[model samples]
Target: MTATPDIVPPTEVRMAEIVFPNHTNHMGTLFGGQALAWMDKAAFLAAARYSRRAVVTARSDQVDFKLPISVGQMVETVGRIVEVGRSSMKVEVELIAEDLHTGERKLCTRGHFVMIALDENHHPTAVPALPADIAGP
Candidate 1:
């Protein structure tokens, strides 16, 4: 759906995925590449939902995997637009791994992804400004 000027960051996109065995590596932890893919997807969805246009991942920076995400945990990715440019949206995507039985939550990774909105012709296009009061995660 198209987003209007009143759209807030938190309302853009929030996704949760279970860390199944298939998502883990032989080390029994979530794979780094998979985590990055999820983060990028979260950012793309947030940007597209807000801009109501096709969007592409431009760049990701400062990705830090603070802790290992174990299998059988719940991975929640919260994406919010941090800033707006002519056609680029800077989004902060935070990954939180939660233990279902123990109720323990840990910050796994946090990264900033820049997504560029595209027009029907696939050219860069403008996007609405993020609400001033909305804070990044």
Candidate 2:
């Protein structure tokens, strides 16, 4: 069985965002758990795009909190399907905070999410190869 490549091209990355609010905070900054949740969601979306099937988080690797996201800031999550196996995908996801008015960007957190493709019965299923152009150099 051939393993998927370790890297995926930047173009394959999918980006999404949500505005921060008081309720999304714990200490005047976006909560770490909230960031993790969004990262997982974005990773799942990226993995599903290639798997063409339902995917669920099987693991998270080395989640690092590098900066703080403040209220009214837009939290943008970028996710990419980096590696694939018989039934699993490794998605690299980054969380960034953007100034709403100025559009400035800062990376807040980054992590790798391992997702498994699921069949109709919710059992693990195989994932197809990513297109050549979308794959890494």
Candidate maximizing lDDT: 1
State in Å the error of residue 6, model 1.
Answer: 6.1
Estimate TM-scores for all models. 0.89, 0.82
Tell how far residue 25 is off in model 2, in angstroms. Answer: 3.6
In model 2, where do residues sit more than 4 Å from their true spots?
Answer: 1-15, 132-137
Candidate 1 per-residue C-alpha lDDT over 9-117 given as tens digits, one digit per residue, 9 for 90 to 100: 3435889999999988899999999999999999999999888889999999899999999999999998988888889998899999999999999888999999999
Pairs in steric clash, model 1: none
Please tell me which predicted candidate would have the highest TM-score against the true structure.
Answer: 1
Model 1: runs farther than 4 Å from truth? 1-11, 135-137
lDDT of 2: 0.81
lDDT, residue 85, model 1 = 87
TM-score of 2: 0.82
In candidate 1, position 89 carries an lDDT of 92
